[model samples]
Target: MGARRMAKGIGEFLMELVGEAVAEVILGLLACALLLSLGLIAYLSWSFSPRLTVAGAGGLSLFLAYGAWGAFRNPSKDRRRRGVAAVATGGFTLAAATAVFLFFYGSDCGCL
Candidate 1:
């Protein structure tokens, strides 16, 4: 009976960890999708002024950076896993920032 209880406890812990991981993945994807949609809108909207575009992009980037930092700063028993999450979050943040910048400023470049 004691061994069976121990097994059940371990199963529960594993399930909880899986749930947390799934939640994190979903949140990350949602963030990326939102940023992508914003970039598309900014790119396609001719009436939106450059100043407003820059301000909106900067604000969004700052907000996302803060959120990503907060979400990934927690101590985890699996350091490697945490490191991967941090890297993924940082990459997504960078991508979002770059998309916003390009949408607003890429036209200024002569190469385009």
Candidate 2:
């Protein structure tokens, strides 16, 4: 094949790989959000408190679940478009989880 065709082939392959990787990560984030949401719900039901964990985890779960669903389901229609969104969702989830951890277990709060 010509060089241009070869380059196009490589670009297509890379795009496909990126889409698949994003899908996997988005799915994983969805699972994490679901689990965290369930845990927070259990804690709320059992403990009954107005705390950072409840609000943060609950909000994170809601955002991730919906965002991941949109990214996972309609990938083909906008593969390149949604791929970035999937990656962003994962990144945001990680940030939210870290913030939640720091807020709940920070030295100032005395959870440790």
Prediction RMSDs, each to the true structure: 15.0, 15.7
Per-prediction tally of clashes: 0, 0
- Tens-place lDDT per residue, model 2, 4-80, is 99999999999999999997666556556655675678777557656766777687677777665654564664455
Best by lDDT: 1
lDDT of 1 at 76: 62
Q: What shift in Å separates residue 46 of candidate 1 from its native position after superposition? A: 3.5
State residue 11's C-alpha deviation in candidate 1, in Å.
0.4
lDDT score of model 1?
A: 0.67
Give the TM-scores of the predictions, in the order they appear.
Answer: 0.43, 0.40
Cα lDDT of model 1 by residue, 6-88, tens digit:
99999999999999999766655555666567667988653568788788878767767765774557656665434555665
Query: Measured by C-alpha RMSD in angstroms, how accurate is candidate 1?
Result: 15.0
Question: How much is 58 displaced in model 2, in angstroms?
Answer: 24
Model 2 residue runs over 4 Å out of place are: 48-112
Taking all chains together, the TM-score of candidate 2 against the true structure is 0.40
